[model samples]
Target: MKLNMVLDNKKTILVLALVLLSFIGIGSLLPEELTLQRWVAAFFAANALVAMALTFVLSTRLEILETIFRGLDRVYKAHRWAGMWSVFSIFMHWWLVPQSETPRDESSLMEIGSDTGEWATWLLLALVVISFMRILPYHLWRWSHRLMGLVFFVSVFHYLFAVRPFQLFSPAGIAMNVTAIVGLAAWWYYAFGKSTSKHHLAKVQNVKKENGVVSFEAKPLQGRPTWNAGQFAFISVLHHEKIAKEPHPFTIASSQHQGVARFSVAGLGDYTKTLYDHLSNGDMVRLDMPYGRFKLNRSSSPQIWMGSGIGITPFVAWLQELNYTGALTSKSCPNVVLYYLVKNAEAAIFAEELQQLTENLPSVTLKIVYSEEGRITPERIADDLNGNVDNAELYFCGNPEVRKAMQEGLESLGMPKNNTHYELFDFRGAI
Candidate 1:
């Protein structure tokens, strides 16, 4: 199996296991005088800090922000596991370090039981509970989620004031604290403060249902940035301000026109269902700036765009973008093949537009797969590949399971790793 395949399957579990092994190794090597538990406690504290950051990034649904935040997720995930191990290490440290031997200036067990520690422990426990039990009511979980920042803050202070080595004398400890503070502030700004209504809202000029998907014609409010095809924006209707702020990322369904942008949203989640029910033409709503790195323009090779369900939204935008720029007319665009998989014929929104686009652009080809009608097995894809699969650049936007399966299957057919690209839609973590 490919490395990406392994990462797709065991990313979280692998991180946790590695952190556990590292903690064990460090604890065994440490001298009796310097217990490993204290070090572990400090490690947990750092991990918690990063986890809090991950929560913020996940909440925003900003694709550009997520691109950066994914790196942070890796760090936070490792930190989380390490931090849990550290908690055990710290417990051991407290157990091993005799009361009489503890420095007089160091915080006593009584201090650990004080108001600050009590609040910190409660908040941390809440975070742990919510992270594990995501099925908890969304609103209730959201209300408790805000407490993570406070927990992180208290934990940092607790580390500095309650721990002895982290005093002004320890440069490494001081640096870690400072880094944590800066990271927390930066994440907070990106998640909340930096976002503005001016760049976020788009006026819905029109709504049309071609097949089953509803496409909204939107013009960003003054000062909002323009977007390219294959890019997506987070959108929320105005009435639910809080939920609106929690934007759901959707691909711009319409091609970029002179003054307006378009987004095609399938009624999937609660927010989307509400949008379909209540939203109307001429309504104004908030939309986060467009963000995503997937673009056909960037590559010179023949392209294979694979979309599942509403995931076809980006390719629609890609075709529109090319058409608007006259690339399609000039025949300058590279050969493109769109493999759109939907549940049924009714779900194939923009089917007419897709057919028209392929007709206009001689280089473009269209393929539709209906899973409800018939299964699309790996052998089928291989049989269909013939000799063309080797050089085709593949891109996917859909659920993780489907994406992983498609990726693995395509790789097995000799497609290179570099040629495959996929987008992550659903956000995870505290936010």
Candidate 2:
């Protein structure tokens, strides 16, 4: 499945190639230690360095970078994998080929650098574990995760100080330093740059609570940021409740030209529940606007959209935008069948709005899949679409577990893996 995804995404393929080549190039510059174990250690260290560096490359938010990955979702996926790979490589480097014992006459600076490197490895290992273990409280995971910058800084210092004189000036050292610098820059931008730039000053115009969700109607304070149908933004409300200062990515649930964008906040975590408690119509909010690649207009293929619970937000945006974007009657608009799975009719929050939106569009159909009657299955989706699954594009915005099951089931029923697209709303993915 991973191989198929990489093959399907040309950008991922290029990134994978570049990382491998860099490792090889860096390894070539290192002097032969004449010992096999030492060579293995050098290889793993080079890999660890390159992997962490690539993690920085994946984490940054640049238009060209997003296009290369096809979306921020893919970039996060790549970042998570690269980070884990680095940790794994570090483990191998530590255990299989132990670091050489320091000389008794080693300088104090060298000793401190060595100690810092050791500490950094431990810190990185803990941080990576917390990132993947979503069971940890988000507040705990978030703040603990930021310590990774310190790790990168220390690791670079260690490399520069602890390595042999010959290697200190080698291509490997230069390459590693370049990567470390990039990683630091990425961290700095993530910590300070992004919030200050691309921020759309906005104020809450209204807030509505419905079916365990709080929907906000926010009016942009300055010129409203131009947006496409399926993008998301990191929203930070000023004078907010606990965890609200930390931005959360929310899909724009209304049309961009509507003068106000809607974000339906589900009470899934501390930030969200607190958002419901404290968010008011006149509250000030900041938006880092227009992110993600879960777009629909480019494809004219018969499209299948799947949404469950709050995952319906992006689809709502698309449905709302279609009328004004000319997609309502465009020849390029594919035949669309949206499946919004929920527990029951009562949980189908947008049932009324969706009905109204689709009333005018003959090409679009909305199906409410109430699991109370029966859970949606691959066979059901195939039959629902009249077996036109072949070559049709499937877009899903929902939880990763459900998306995995759906993808697997669809693939078993003869749907191409590459035919499906999804946006993981997992905000932990933001950086």
RMSD of 1: 5.8
Instruction: Give the Cα error of residue 118 in candidate 2, in Å.
Output: 2.1
List model 2 lDDT by residue over 1-431, tens digit each: 34545665776677789877876786687766537777777677667777777777666677777777778777787788888888988777667655666464455777776676677778887788778776677666767766777777777787777644346556766776777788888877765565455678898877888777999877876786877888998888887654357678899898786767789988887778888776778888888878988876545556788888899989888887776666444544457988888889888888888888888777888899888999888888888778877766678987767777888887888787687787766647544
Candidate 2 clashing pairs, residues 3+ apart or interchain? none
**Model 1 lDDT tens row, 138-256:** 54555565666666566556555554434443554554556567656755665357556425666887787655457777776666467767777667667653234455667777665
Q: Which stretches of candidate 2 lie over 4 Å from their true place?
A: 1-8, 96-103, 134-136, 165-167, 241-243, 298-300, 327-331, 427-431
Every candidate's lDDT: 0.61, 0.76
For residue 168, model 2's alpha carbon misses the true position, in angstroms, by 3.2
TM-score of each: 0.76, 0.89
- Cα-based RMSD of the predictions, in order? 5.8, 3.3
